[model samples]
Target chain A: MTTGVRRRMGVEERRQQLIGVALELFSRRSPDEVSIDEIASAAGISRPLVYHYFPGKLSLYEAALQRASDDLAARFVEPKEGPLGARLLRVMGRYFDFVDEHGPGFSALMRGGPAVGSSTTNALVDSVRQAAYVQILAHLDVTDPPARLDLVVRSWISLAESTALIWLDGRRIPREELQAQLVHDFAALAAVSAAYDEEMSALLRRILADEPADGPFADLVGQLIELAS
Target chain B: MTTGVRRRMGVEERRQQLIGVALELFSRRSPDEVSIDEIASAAGISRPLVYHYFPGKLSLYEAALQRASDDLAARFVEPKEGPLGARLLRVMGRYFDFVDEHGPGFSALMRGGPAVGSSTTNALVDSVRQAAYVQILAHLDVTDPPARLDLVVRSWISLAESTALIWLDGRRIPREELQAQLVHDFAALAAVSAAYDEEMSALLRRILADEPADGPFADLVGQLIELAS
Candidate 1:
């Protein structure tokens, strides 16, 4: 059988091409299912060339994971326009988009298996989470959040990630509903945190002030009061 | 050194004993680090005896995971006490206790590694989640819930499990605080669902009636309204 014509690309270009191919395969299947030979063949290169870029399958998998991490982190970057609630909704929309676009890779990246559950992969995942935390704080306009606010934000992030994972896995809920539920959960968590922390409480009041009176935010508040009374 | 005296227990007893020993080991270390030799040694039995009960390490790991699942499911059972919120808190306390006691085994069972990520283990985990869902519905006194209520309850269960896993991994927040946070998230998710579904809205009203005027539930409702207005 004749092999496909290979392009003479520069080192960085060739490396990126190999990683891009690997990412697609890894997204579809676990790391163990994807072989160096398949990746090399997919790139129309020799196995030695693949090895030259990544010493082994695990290394190649990590590189792909890193690329995915970068892509996901970039997706969290929304314009700091409008109210915090509106900005969060936009950010969550992009997050949902990323999860939709990179379904398998997002699962593999967020929910690591034995093949990719090493400390290296854990660090990569943590970096993505940290990036998310930084972006959320930036949206909150908090450069140095207190410990309670920090914990609440981190916990909400975990909740969001888990919610997204289940939503993707189940395929039952609509993406918009899930996104709205998440944004509501974020506000609820922030309000809950505010009950105990002055800083979060103050920040929440400010955000709520920016929310429209008849929007979902106002509806959430109305429901809360209805339940209380 | 002389081998210690080994008790010749019945087959089922021996199998249970081996699983108990394996559970202890897996609770302390990952499955890869625990070997048949270590399990046999821990049980003061021969490697062949360990294999006799479990065909291999994977089977043994599955058994340990099953045991963990059983224990976790059992922990979700709370008495039909005064109020749904209080019953949930009691159930959550027991759940947190189980997680705290199981530690690494809890992590392994909840976050399945490739070693134990088989369909068998997945079924076992699903059973535990289903149990939690049933218990929650029972607490709500819902004989037949709508799809939206089912989805919300199931999602909250996932959120609770994910929150527990993160709390265990991070070890930043106190167990009580995390447990309270999860219970709060459960209520918030329910309330958010209520905003869309009439059945859930009615159920939320019933749960709110049981909550004390000056309790955390009331405080949560108060804070939410305060932030909104």
Candidate 2:
């Protein structure tokens, strides 16, 4: 590692580097358990320099959290023209892969849920979740009141958060087995949120446009309303 | 408040008093934050007397936790015999009432989930959670394989735990409002658990026998499945 290369980095790069290092440490231990002094030492900068970017430890912690959320959001919000279902599956796949590689970071987030208010964390999680819902809503050609859309989106957020926690816990299920279940679950959840047969059928067309027409998930969600009825 | 009255108490009564006092403290603060001396002092007894029934602070914490779980399980397994829908609704009503009274204890249980795997707390939480599941299963007519039954029960547990946290965190959705939404969600989840319509219908029949027939949640499970399909 060259000092010249580190010195020449822009402010944005420095911020990202701090978050990256903080996430590494936070994954291994609670944020409180780690000190700003330690984070600064690990980042190879003076403690005051760390404070220059972040006002304090709490600010830094929230910033690192925001960085993680932004990283996740980038994967979820694709260009508006793709097949919704396939894009959704890709987002979920990316989610699982991210958690798989950052097991500690995932655990830290789950553990942080109660320490922070849902409103605090939801700002990050809700944005990524709503972006996915937008694709479905757009493809379904539906127009609804914003409040109702928000409720539906929050419900989907709850399901995805629950599913994410289950996967992150790394219990008995393998990643493949878990991802397969999520694909089915997310599709069913999406269909329910749309709440229009014509809309669903169109959404299904969009979903199947980019993938094989008859996965188990397609069959399962294909008859979701029937099973629900 | 007479000294004579206090001295006349039996060993069982004294132990119960100690537990009651310990629970009051434990509910307000984490286990580590409270101590044997404080508990004994709060109960108006000597420290050694507190240890006579519970060998140590951990045992006392476990005992208090077990009592809370037992109380919750008892409410869930009410003996009322009627339509499945009515019974289910009654149980849910009781469950929500329990939350209103004991939300802190329930929140503590959830926040303690990650701690269960730690050496200091695992056995108590695992056993109590298992006992709670047994109570839930006894109320259901599950014919799924044991593994599936375990997953179904865990799914319900997850829902209940998450719902309790949402409520405890002061979302303050009216009891009926929350229960109605839950009934819908659980019904859809129940339908998806089993394969055949007959089996699903039968399960719903048994469940509906425990709920009211004409309310918003009465046929919500079937309706949600239909909407999904």
Candidate 3:
């Protein structure tokens, strides 16, 4: 299978295009269900030409996974402004957008197992988690988080990751609500920590000072007040 | 290498003993790091005897996992009497007790990957999650949960899972604190859902009415109010 409108392209450009194509195919279905031939055909290139870039299917899968891992890490990056609650909500919006687009791939990244058992894949997953953790700490403007603060941030990061993994199954809940609930989830985890630790209490006070009335943090406070009353 | 003080036992009892021995060894170290010979020596039996019960290492590993899985599900079983907050805190305590006892095996159970790629192992993990979910719903007295309630419960389950996984790495934070924080987490996730859903709001009202002044739920509400003020 070849494209009639094929035009000259650089090797790196062609490699990038192939990775994109493989990710698209993998996202629609399991990576195992997608063959190297299908990838070559999808790329409008010959099978041998596909092998010329990557040795085999597994290599190509890992390469595409690497690309996806980077994109996912990039999703957590946000300009530091506004309420921490709003910033996190926006991050979740983009985070779910990634999960929504790459459903199966995202599952594979989080759940590893024998099907995608390469240490390389597991390492990629770890890197994404580490990146998210670092991004959250950067958001908190803390060079060194205290013991309990460390627990709160790490727990929140893991919560967000697992929340996305579970949401990927049928995606029954509205994405917008999950995105907002996750922001609230972070607040809840930190709030509990603040109650137990003075260091976390101070950090939380600083965080809430910037949070607006309409932000998820304030919304959680309002709901708690109503429940208490 | 022989296990001293061996006593004659029935076939079924011997099989259970081997499974227990295998689990104990697997807990201290990765399963791959363990050997069939070591298992037999620990059981004070011959290497071929382990084979008599299980066909191979993978089978023995799975049997150990099955036993561990049942023990974990049992950890969630609590009598239906007290406030849900106290009940959940007890559950977290028992859950962490299991985690502290079965460190590496618990990691293998959660992380899966190629090291433990068998479908049976993955199913065992799924069944444990289902068991935990069902047990939590029973505690709530809800046979059928609303969509958002489903998300809240499942998200809380996942949060508990990842929190435990992260805690196992060096376990720097105090276990008792993590346990209490997890109960607050469930309340937080549920409170967020209740804010938006009438069914959840009504359910939260029932749960909170039975909660005492000193329970985790009351503590969370008190913390949120403190932050707001």
Candidate 4:
């Protein structure tokens, strides 16, 4: 890529380019801290030209958030062919990857704070959660989950999210281990819920049946057996 | 209380009164939607006087958030005298009480969004989670917890927060059930962690020893046993 080439970009292309630039900048620092001047300079364009695509900071911030929301939601999309444990582990991998690159922006959006947290932004963030829920449901092949099942999945989603957010603060825990532990956490949640409801009990059995002995779910079982012994 | 009695209040007293007024208003609606003018009116004071007491909306919102932060953290402080399940249930009752009244503001704060989510406000909110961690540690009576224990507690805190936040959206679940489920979740999380670590196993045993048959934690054990048999 030539640095000095002043190639003309189409309107939509320029908008996409600006959103990408703003996302990169916002990802590095909190949205409140990143200014328009930085965004323009990073894009190698004039500030007013950037505003021509976006009317103001709020608009650009929303645009970036929308982009990030789509990207983050896509992380939860997994092929359902593999064991549930493996599928979930891959999902966690992508999630942490997104968190690794977009910590500040994702954290602020998730926490519902910092600059540009309008209703639209809030909805965008929520859509990500909603999307994750749907994807998890699809993986389970269940259209209507039981109440305990609902609680376990939603709680695990929250756990994964909060785990990633806190992990970003200092990353004290090893990433790979946290990822595995999160999968175990999900299995544990479902297993505990299994004891509460018949539907949940059946669902938990069905899930554990397909998992390999070496999978994260089996690791959880092995750990539990250690306690029993 | 007499009707329309305008009593002259002292400086600190007046500030506290204003904070209380702002808290009620913020509790009912998102802080961004609740204007300073509304707060002033709610306090039965002139807008100028309100501004005189607190320079601006952000300052006033911070004051309200600070007060809320203290209230929230206090809810986590159990007597450490009962079965862990009963103690946690009581704490959840108070927590849900806060959520019932302060859903909008608390949700907005916990999610990290909307107006007045400055670094200071974020810190204040974080302090509440930190305090809850300390209080739970005191309940468990552990000076230094294992790494897995740390993960479980912090993850549970995040779980409770997200659970309450999501429940507030439409409250589809019965409040009493959700509250009880939350205590079960804590036990589930700890029980899972116990299988992973010896320290956690011993701790789980100790926590379960004092709990009654009908307690939430025992109910979880009973449910799980039903799955086994």
Tell me the fnat of candidate 1.
0.40
- Among these predictions, the greatest DockQ belongs to 3
- Model 2 chain B scores worst on lDDT over the 10 consecutive residues at B113-122
lDDT of 4 by residue, B1-229 (tens): 7879777899899999999999998888877788888998989889999988999988888998899889888878878687888998999999999899898888777665555357788788779989989988999989898777888898899998878887887786678877887888888788776765677889888888888988888787766554543
Docking class of 3: medium
Compared with the true structure, the alpha-carbon lDDT of candidate 3 equals 0.84
Going through the candidates in the order shown, the clash numbers are 0, 28, 2, 7
| Candidate 2 vs candidate 4, TM-score winner | 4
| Full-model lDDT, candidate 2 | 0.60
What's the TM-score of chain A alone for every prediction?
Answer: 0.90, 0.70, 0.92, 0.94
Which whole-number lDDT from 0 to 100 does residue A47 have in model 3?
95
Please, what are the lDDT tens digits per residue for candidate 2 over residues A1-229? 5564635568888888898898778666656577999999999998999998888776677777777777776666555654444555666788777666556656655544333433445365546656666655655455662432334344554555555565555454455544555555555444443433354445544554554446545555545444434
Q: Per-candidate TM vs. native?
A: 0.81, 0.58, 0.92, 0.85
Model 3 pairs whose backbones collide: A113-B113, B3-B44
Cα lDDT, all candidates: 0.78, 0.60, 0.84, 0.82
Error of 3 at B213 (Å): 2.4
lDDT of candidate 4 over A26-135, digit per residue (tens) = 89888878899999999999999988999998889999989988988987888879799999999888888899999888777666455535777867867888999999
What docking class should model 2 receive? incorrect
Runs off by more than 4 Å, candidate 2? A1-87, A99-222, B1-5, B8-12, B28-42, B46-59, B78-85, B112-120, B135-140, B143-150, B192-218, B221-229
Regions more than 4 Å wrong, model 4: A1-6, A32-37, A46-48, A56-58, A111-113, A145-148, A209-214, B1-6, B32-49, B111-113, B144-146, B194-215
